[model samples]
Target: MKILLLTPQFPYPPHQGTTLRNFNLIKGLARRHRLRLFSLLAPGDAPAGTPVTDLVEHLVTAEQPRRSMARRLRDLVSTPLPDMALRLWDPRNFDTLLEHCRAHPPDVLQIEAIEMAPYLFGLLAAGVRPPRIVYDAHNAETLLQRRAFLADVRRPRRWVGAVYSAIQTLKLRRYERRLLRSVDAAAAVSEADAAELRSMAPDLPLAIVPNGVDLSAYDPRHPYPNPYGRSGPNLVFTGKMDFRPNVDAALWFADRVLPLLHASNLGPHFWIVGKSPHPRLRRLRNRPDITITGAVPDIQPYLAHADLFVAPLLAGGGTRLKILEAMAMQKPVVSTRLGADGFPVQDGVQLALADTPARFAARCLELLQHPERAAELARRGHAFVTAHYGWEKIIPGLETLYSSNDTLTGASDRR
Candidate 1:
C-alpha cells in the first residue's frame, strides 16, 4: 500500500509515547508498503536523520504555528472559529500536501492527530478524489483540555481556556463526523476512546488500534544507571515537559506528592526528563531534590537505573508509553488512576495505583522499602507488556485496517 502519513511531530528519537508508537508503525509499515510522509513539527525543529528521506519515498516538513498570546488573540479575532484560526496559519503545509497529491497521490492518507484534520477539510471541500482519511487519534486532545478546565485554573483565564476547549472540541467533532461519513475508517489508541467516538458518531467506522512500544530498543539487557541518581532513591517522570499535561503532572507531583515523602529524608529525588522543559517546570529546579534534564540522547539507561518509575500525571488522554516502557524494562511503577487510565493492568500486580498525594507517596515509599515486592511488580509489568503491548503483535491490526478498504485510494497510486 502507498500511505501518506501526516503527524505533528517526527516519530524518531521516540522518547515520548506518541512518537514511539507512530515511529515504530511508520518504520514497520515502511518495510512493507510504499510510504510518502507529510509530517509537521514545532518551529525551528527538525527530526535528526536521513532515515526518513532515505527509507520513505519522500518527506514533507512544515512548522506549526507558534502559540502566543498575540497569535491567540489574532486568531480569535480574525476567524469566526478560534480553533481553525489557531491552525490556519499552516496554509503552506496544505499547499505542500496538495502539490504532493497532484504529482504522486497516495493509496491511503493516515493523519496522526486532530490538529492536522483541518488541512484535509479544505482538500475534501475542493472535491479531491476521496482518499482513505484515517484519523490516527493519538489522544482525545480536547478532553485533556476539558479536564484541565475542570481542575482549579485561575478565575478570569479559566473561562477563556474553557471556551477555547469547547471551540476546539466542536471543530474536531464536526470534522470527525464528516470524516466518519466520507472516509474509509478511523482508529484510537484504546477501546475506551473508540467507544466514546462511536457513541458520538455511531455510524462512524472505528477500531481500537493501540499504541505499541518497540521492545528491541527499549531493552533491559542494556540498562544505564540513573543519570539524575544522587545518594538517595530516584523517582523519574519522563515525558515532553513543555506539554501542558506533563507540566501539570510534574508540578502536582513536586508540590503534593514529593513533599509528603520529604519527611522521611530517605533522599527522595525526582528527575523530570524529556525535551523542551517549560518555564513552569524550570521553576521546579529551585527545589534541591528536583532536577530537570531538558532532553537526553536515550531514556533506557535512566529507566534501568531508577529505583522506581513514577507517573503522578492527573491530566491527559490516551495510554502512557513512558509507563509501558518503564514496565518493559522491568522497573517498578507507581501511577495515578489518570496515569494508568487506559491500560489493562491491575493494582499491586503489574503496577501500583495511587491517586492522592499521601497514597502516592506511601506507595512509592513502600516500593523503595520492600525490594522483593518491588522486584515482583517489575517482573509482572514486564510480562504484561511483553504478552499484550509489544509492537510486533499490535501493529498487524493497523495493517489490517489499511488493507480492509482497498477501494480507499491514497495520495499515491502504488497500492
Candidate 2:
C-alpha cells in the first residue's frame, strides 16, 4: 500500500512524546507500505543522527507558525476553532500538500493527531477528493483542557482557566465530532482516548495504536553509573519543561513534594531535565538542591544515575512516554495514577503511585531509602516493558491498523 502519513512535527530524534509516537509508528508502517511523511516542522529545528528520511519514499515538511501570547489569545477568542488544532493551520502548506496529492494520490491518508487533521479536512473543505482518511486521535482534547483547569495549582489562575477551558472544550468537542464524521478510519494512542473517540463517532473504524519507544536503544545496564554528571541522592523528572502540565508538575512538586524530602534531611537532589524550560520553572535554579538541566544532547544518563524517576503530573492525557522510557531503563518509577495511564502493571508491583503531595513525596522517600525493594520494582518494570511496550512488538499493531481495509461499521460518515 502507498500511504501518506501526516504529522504535526517531524518524527526524527524521537526525543519527546509526540515525536516518539509518530517516529515509531511511521518507521513500522514504512516496513510494509510505501510511505510519504508530510510533517509540519518548525524552521531550523530539524534533528540529526536519526535516519528518518531513510524510512519513507518521500518526506514533506512545512514551517510551523510561531505566535506570540498576545496574538494567540486574540485568535483563541476570535476563532471558533481551538488554537490547539488551528496552530497547525497553514493555507500555503495545505496548498502544497494538496497539489502533490492531486498529482499523485496515495492509497490512504493517516493524519497522526488532531493537530494535522485540519490539513486533510481543509483540502476536503476546498472540494478536493481526499483518500481514505484515518484520524489518529492522540488525546481526548476536551478532557485534556478540562484537566488543565482542574489540576492547576495556582488558585488565582484556576477561575480564569476554568472559563477558558469551558470555551475551548466546547469548541474542540464540536471540532472532533465534525472531523471524525469525515474520516474513513481512526486510531487512538490509548484505550482511554479510543473510548472517548468511540463515544463521539460510535461507528468510526478506530483502533488503539499507542505511543512506543525503541527498547533496543534504552538499556538499564548500559546507562547505569552514567559518566554524565552526579550529585546527591538524585530524583529525576523528564519532559518538555515548557509544557503547562510539566511546569505545573515541577512547581507543585518543588513547592510541596520536594520540600518534604528536604525537610526530612534526606538530602535528596531533584533534577528536572528537558529542553525549553519555562521562565517560571527556571526560577528554581536559585535553589541549591534543584539542578535544572535545560537541554542535553542525551537523557539516558540522567535517567540511569537517578535513585528514583518521579512523575508528579497533576494533569495531562495519554500515557506518559517518559514513564515508559524510565521503566524500560529498569528504573523504579513513582507517578500519579494519571501519569501511569495505559499501562497494565500494578502500582506496587511495578512502581509506586501517589496523588497528593504527601503521598507523592512519601513514595519518593520510600523508594530512595529502600535500595533492594526499588531494584526489585525496577526489575519487574523493565521486564513488563520488554514483554509488552517495545516498539518492535507494538509497531506491528499500528502497521496492521494502517493496512486494515475494514468497512465502516456504523452509519455513513457525512460526505
Candidate 3:
C-alpha cells in the first residue's frame, strides 16, 4: 500500500504523547508500505533530519506560521471554523500533498486529527478525488475542550479561559459532526474517544487503535540512579511543560495536593520533568519541595528512581502514553480516575486511582509507606502492558484497516 500520512506536528524525538504515537505508527507502517510523511513544524522547531528517513519513502514539512492572539481572535470573529482548525490549516500543506499526489497518487490518506481535517476539506473543495481517507483521532477534541472548560470552574480566577473553552467546544463539536461524516474511516486512541465520534456519525467506520509503549526502550533492567538525591519521597510527572493540561496538572499537584502531604508530616519532592517549561510553571519555583526541570535529555533516570509516578491530570482526553511507558519501566503510578481514563486496568491491581487533593495525597502517602504494595502494582502493570500494549501488537490491526476494502460494520478493537 502507498500511504500518505498527515500530522499536526513533527513526530521525531517521540517524547510527547501524540508525537510518540505518530513516530511509532509511521515507523511500523513504513516497513510494509510505501509511506510518505507530511508533518507540521512550528516556527522555531528544528526540523531534525531523517528520524523517519530510515522508515519513510519521502518527508515534507510545512512551517506553521507563528501563533498570534490577534490572528486567532480575528479568525474566531471572522470565520465559522474552530480557531484551532483555522490555525492549523495551511493551504501550502495541501499544495505539498497535491504536488506529491500528482506524481504518485497515494493508496490511502490518513489524517492525524480534526486539527488536520481542514487540509482534507481544502482538497475536497479543490475537487480532488483522493484515495480512502482515515481520521486518526488522538482524542475527541470536543470532549477535551468541554472537560477543560468545566475544570476551570474550580479555578474561579480563570473565568476567561473557561469562557474561551466553551466557545471552542461549541464550534469544534459542530465542525467535527459535519466533517467526520465525510471520512471513509476513523481510528481513535481510546474507547472514550471512539464513543464520542460514533455518536456524531454512527455509520463512520471506526477502530480503537489504543496508544502503546516501546517495551525495549523502557526496559526495567536498565539501571537508572536517582537524579534528585533527596531523602524525602519523590514524585514525578512528565510531559511537555508548555502544554496547558500538563501545566495545570503540575500546578494542581503542587499548590493543592502537595500542601496536604506536607501537613501530614511527610516530606515530598515533586519533579516536573520535560521540555519547554511554561512561564506560569516557573511560579512553582518558589516552593522548595518542587523542582521543575525545564528540559531533560532523558527521563529514564527519574522514572527508574522516583518513589512514585503521579499523574493528576484533571483535564485532557485519550489514554496517557506516559503512564504506559512508566508501567513498562516497572514503576508504581497513581493517577486521577480521569488520568487513567480509557485504558483497561483495575484500580488497585495495576495502579492507584485518586481524584481530590486530599484523596490524592493519601494515596501518595500509602505508596510511600507501603513499598511492597506499590511494587506489586508495578509488577502487574508491567506484565499487563507487555502482554497487550506493545507497539508491534497494536499497529497490525491499524494496518489491516488501511489495506482492507471490506466494509467495517462499526468501531472495533483488537482485543
Candidate 4:
C-alpha cells in the first residue's frame, strides 16, 4: 500500500511520545508499504539526513506556524475552533499536501494527531477527493482538556488555566466529533482513549494501537555512563518539561513529595531530564538536591543511572511513552495510578503504584533502600514491556487496519 503520513513535528529522534509513535509506525509500515511523510518543522528541529529520511519514499516539511499569546487570546473569542486546530494552521503545508496528492497520490492518508487534523479538514473543504483517511488520536483531546480543567480547578492559583481548559474542552469536543465523523477510520493509543472517541462518534471505525518503544534502542544490556556522577540514589522523571502535565508533576513532586523523602533521611537526589524546562521549574534550582538538565543529547543514560523512575503525574491522558522506555531499560518505577492508567501491570508486581504525596514518597524511598526488591520489579517490568509494548508487536494491529477493504470503501461514505 502507498501511505501518506502527516505529523505535527519531524519524528526523526523520537525524543518524546508523539514522535516515538510516529517514527516507529513509519519504520514498521515502510517494511511493506510505500510511505511518504509530510511534517512541520519546529524552530530547533533539524531533520536532514536523519534515519527517518531513509524510512520513507519522500519527505516534505513546512515551518510550524507560531501564534502569539495575543493572537491566541483573540482566537479564543473570535473562532469556535479549538486551540489545537489553529496551532499548525499554515497555507504552505496545505498547498504542499495538495501538490503531492496530485503528483503521487497515496492509498491512505494517516494523520498523527489532532494538531495535524487541520490539513485533513482543509483537503475536504477544498473538495479534493481524498484517500482513505485515518485520524490517529494520540490523546482523546476533549477528554484530555476536561481532565486538565478538573485538575487545575482544584488549585486556587491555577484558576486562570482552569478557565482556559474549560473553554478548550467544549471546542475540542465539537472539532473532534467532526474530524472522527469525516475520516474513514480512526486509531487510538489505548482502550481508554478509544472509548472516549467512541462516545463522540459511535459509528466511527476505531482501532486501538497503543504507543510502543523501539526495543533495540532501549535495550537494558547496553552500558551507559552514569549521567549523574555525584548522585546518591538519583530519582529521575523525564519528559518535555515545558508540557503542562510534566511541569505540574515535576513541581508537585518536588514541593510535596521530595520534602517527605528528605525527612526520611534518604538524602536522595532528584533529576528532571528533558528538553525545554519550563520557567516555572527554575525555582527548583535553588535546592542543591535537584538538577534540571534541559535538552540532553540522549535520555537513556539518565534512565540507566536512575535508582528509581518516578512519575508523579496528576493529570494527563494517553499512555506515557517515557514509562515504557524506562521499563524497557529495566528500571523500577513508582507512579501514580493515573500515571499508569492504560497499562495492564499489577501495582506491586511490575512496579509500585501510589497516588498521594506521602504514599509516593514512601514508595520511592522503599525502592531506593532495597535494591533486591527494586531489581525484581525492574525485571518484571522489562519482561512485561518486551512481551507487549514493543513496536514489532504493536505494528501488526495498524497494518491490519490499513489493509481492511472496509476502510478503503468507507471513504466514499464519509465524503
| Number of backbone collisions per candidate | 9, 0, 0, 0
Ranking by TM-score: 4, 3, 2, 1
- Give the distance in Å from residue 143's predicted Cα in candidate 3 to where it truly belongs: 0.7
- Looking at candidate 1, the ten consecutive residues that score lowest on lDDT are 406-415
Clashes of 1: 9
Per-model TM-score, in order, reads 0.90, 0.93, 0.95, 0.96
Put down candidate 3 lDDT per residue, 1-415, tens digits, no spaces: 8888888888877888878999999987877889888888865556556568668888878887565888888877677778778878766677987777677677888988778888888777777656688888888999898899999866889788898888889999999887788778888777889889888998777778889898888999987776997875888999999878888999999988999888767688899999899998877888899999877878888898888999999999988998998999999999999899988888899999999999999898888888999999899999988988988888876765664573442223444
**Roughly what TM-score does model 3 have, to 2 decimal places?**
0.95
TM-score of 1: 0.90
Against the true structure, whose lDDT is highest?
4
lDDT by candidate, in order shown: 0.76, 0.79, 0.84, 0.88
For residues 287-394, write the lDDT of model 1, one tens digit per residue: 889889888889887788888899988777878899889999999999998889878778999999998899999999999999899999999999988887777766
Q: Of the pair 1 and 2, which is ahead by TM-score?
A: 2
Best candidate (score: TM-score): 4
Model 1 lDDT, residue 213, Cα: 75
Alpha-carbon lDDT of model 1? 0.76
